[model samples]
Target: MSQAPASGSIPDSTALETGASEPGARRPYLTRTRMAAVLGALTLVLIVVCAAAVMFGSVPVDFTRAIADRTSPDHAILFAARMPRVLMGAVVGAILAAVGAALQALVRNPLAEGGTLGISSGAAFGAILAIVLTYRFGGGSAIVPAAGFAAALISTLAVYRLGQMHGRVEPFTLLLVGVIFNTFWSALILLINSLVNLYQTRSILFWLVGSLEAPTYGEVAAVSALGAAGFVWLGWHARDMNLLSLGDEPAHDLGVDVDGARRAIFIATSLMIGGAVSVSGMIGFVGLIVPHILRLAFGADHRLLLPASFLGGAAFLVAADLAARVAIAPAEIPVGVITALCGGPFFIYLLRREGHRGIAV
Candidate 1:
């Protein structure tokens, strides 16, 4: 999946520019001024989406009363219910998209994402297993995060290692790895679900479908803190992300700690994925769709792509959640359902487009 671009195309700046020369000046569309403007606009969009998510649920909220008067009934609906869920959605989206952007660069795969690479499946399996264990054993759901993290780390490394041939992640190898890992984890999750009691099965199934329920400030804070940490880690290595696209041998020759950087990045992304799946189930496509769109728009400079993907993803998931809340009125659907509806077609389209462009069959 190393999208090094076919020789015939006037490849985007992503394929052509080395960050070593003139930095942001080489990409006319991705200059420093333009990057800042794009990021600012994305921030504004996220804010607007968040506000809309808060206000436009099935129950009409007295928006001003909720904000100004803590005693009002609307206040509970806004602060105690909607706000935390919306915030959680935003942070989860940010984590996915930011990490996805980094993975695309690291894997040199235009189509790389958490779902496509099996990270989400791994985390979801971990969280699902933890839920089953907690019910069978006496421990609370607090163990979910640790379980999810460990599983996510293992699955991530397994896929990343298998996907890489020599130093590069071959497109065919990555696709096969995704299929194998995803099928394996999903089957295991299903097996666990089949054995559990009705109540436990319901819980496991909810996560499988992906929901943003049990809205609470604690969940928001936990997700935000971890997501922020991962964001910083990826941002710190944005330069290396760029260099890695130049090939591992070339990158190492240019002073990149290839092994160390790859390890750190996988760990950071796995941490974020585990935390998110533990809380929000398997919310799909935020990681895949957001970064792919941003890279296309901003030319794959991880420096610009990461932040833009974060903001765009926040807006996207927030909006998707809002749709999930109201799309069926009073009765809401899973957020994952909405994302899959959007992403499934997008994924097929991307594959078809890639095929037409001469990507390997």
Candidate 2:
């Protein structure tokens, strides 16, 4: 699952060239300045898509008036019903993309993501546990997310530890370990559901399917906070993630502290995944598919891959969520279901390509 480029592809140096006047001076097109322009274009596209998402829904509301009138019904619908969900999609999309970028580098596994490796499941278990505890303690919605965050962190740590074999962690081994952990956690969740009352079971089932059914303002704010933190933190590590594509030994020889970097990435990835799970509850494939698509579209440099995936991921989820809302008309579909339905085939396609021709890390 590692997003490393296939052997013999031109390096990112094409984005730059020697100055026209000098033999080796960098050229205008290949300059970092142009890369910034590309990123700006992506950002512009994402903004337009987000605006479209905010505008299209069951009851089409004029966004201009909605934003201006705090007391209008359209405002209520836009602010209370739609805004949070849109923001959640953006946050989750960015977090998932960033996590995918990091994990692919961390373990050199392209398929690595919060959902695939049981991190989301683990986080869900924690959140569920918190919910049960809150029910007993007479707590509120805030407690639920807090509990979920703890669970997500714990689950990711457990997976990381177990995935390590003889002081090394291979992508395939980590994938296997993640599957096992995912099964265990999923079963645990089911067991908890069984022991709980019927109401709780129904609630758990709904949450498990994943939804963008308009989060509370508090939830949206918290998700935004965590997501922003993770995004900022990971942006600093973009170069490290790029270097890591060469594999751990080579990365180490190049002065990258393999173990320390892995630890940081793991923690960062867990936090991002946990935050996303806490808010969105185990949406799958944004991570796996987003990075791959970016890889194909923009090449494998993490510098470009990371931001492109983020923008692409945000657009992808928002569009899918919009589809889920309109496709069923009055009855909204769980966003997770839609993403899986759409992304599953793409995932299979990726597998087909991998089987036919492998990328060397």
Candidate 3:
């Protein structure tokens, strides 16, 4: 009855449907090929940065000799001090950044981070508690991390519960509740410090400010194992995260168990944060800054964003640690101080940007 459509022409019904969706559709800038290129580039940069971290510390050491000849004069410094610290930095940084990206998606809040959620404070409190107990009663170093992990999980779950209302989590409400919990834990840490001796107080202060000064090989291995496990788990759920970002109703309609996905992501992020804070103390901003930068460069696709964030974060902290080592030359600044210096301004910018949008989630 009707003439056939011309070759290369879409049918009228198809054309109409496509036009109807055009206004709401978003085109991604990073294609599969482009994402691969960017990831490869970031990985190369990470490798170069890791080498530099080992080579350029407070002391001058020949990079080639440090790697080639263990008998070289710098061998002890390279292996005993710098290598473990650098590896710790890499592990902690990657965990923070990857978890940050996942949490941001889960909460639908760009400002979400471990420190903001009180997870770091809770971990620090637990570690400090273990330190005090060990100092008085005597125990292995393992007690601190174990306590920290338990405390971090408890605090995160508490926050998660506080943030929910009528089975929904409002992003702004969650942020506010997290801030309150952080303040409460911070004050409690100070109170505990007051009760301890001078040496313990000093150690607690160092942990609070954060450092990568003296990580043992065993601590490095433990954190690496935990971090790798968390990364893989989060990566497996990356598709669900992408779907969740499209809004709850749409995600639910598409067969995502919204509440279950949220809970899983929350637990996964807490585990990553706990493992890191247990080892490195409260290193903030790496999580907040690394994920944000990568999201801008790539897109909000978690599959790519999560891995990219890990690599980028590893490189970033390694470089930051290197700067912390040499910036004072024989006296080191806390790595946290350097990250805060960078993150503080960025935080202000985020607030201002949100203000322009009327602070809507």
Candidate 4:
């Protein structure tokens, strides 16, 4: 006869297999010195990409002239058009990626993402609603973003509630509800578009597909502020996230407030996702791609993972946006198209790899 395990002692298989006491759990793979170097490299790459973006618009821009004279036409195009769009792309990408990393850690699901939670779909619906209302009945400038944020929060709360079973949120249930919500909201958006005029319909379609075109300074500033706050909050809770990843019971035993941490991170991610969707439209896969790649490169230590996701996400989206601009020369494809093209294949690959394990992290 085998003896029962002690009440508080973690079993070896349970602890090690579930990421509670894995190798390198005591210390992350990327040290501070290495992280700093990586960040510096990513930043340098971002700067170079931004410069290229500014220089390669539909109309030719002289970089030398733009730098020399801010008053010149080339400078006007660079500062007024390209700079804001590029900055918005970076901000949106960082927020999405960081939020993705946090959500994945929170639920212990590799496939968990903002879209998987219905936040993006809700946000898109809200944005579309705002556009329709603005066209039908004039509203203030803040209506679109405010509506989007509100809808996102509501949808996330609904998912949270629906995912709860006996006081615990189940990852698969949440994902299922999210899929339903996304389908519903997408149909609603299409229905609304059908009722609207041609111009409004075009606008809604463009936003739904996503774009980094003609972003204004005000929009960029708002997204940056919100994204910064979200990033800081997520980073501060990174260690807590690591604890939560080892299943809820183990996390509680480790002194982590599992519920509180999940709630806080959910809200933070919602803010970031809503802000990005409101500004940049419905760009997908940034969150999915960035976090997974970083996890494969560096171990799943949120302290390093979250920040690396931010930097890598910023660089990735900037590069994608650049491709969107130059791929068709005078005519530009939406950045969302490019991301989907990249993310779709990778997503399939992940599905196949995780299929046996049911895609749970």
| Count of steric clashes across candidates, in order | 2, 14, 0, 0
What is the per-residue lDDT of model 1 for residues 219-309, given as tens digits with 9 covering 90 to 100? 8898899999989998888889988877788789999999999888989999998998889988877777898888777787788888899
Better of 3 and 4 by lDDT: 3
Residue 106 lDDT (model 4):
81
Error of 3 at 210 (Å): 1.1
Give the Cα-based TM-score of candidate 1 against the true structure. Answer: 0.89
Candidate 1 lDDT: 0.84
Better by lDDT, candidate 2 or 1: 1
lDDT of 2 by residue, 163-270 (tens): 777767666778778878888988998999988898889778866777777688887778878877877777777778878888778888888887787777777778
RMSD of 3: 4.6
Give the per-residue lDDT of model 3 (tens digit) for 77-108: 88989999999999999998998888888777
Steric clash pairs (candidate 3): none
What lDDT score goes with residue 294 in model 4? 84
Cα miss at 162, model 4 (Å)?
2.2
List clashing residue pairs in candidate 1: 1-170, 1-171
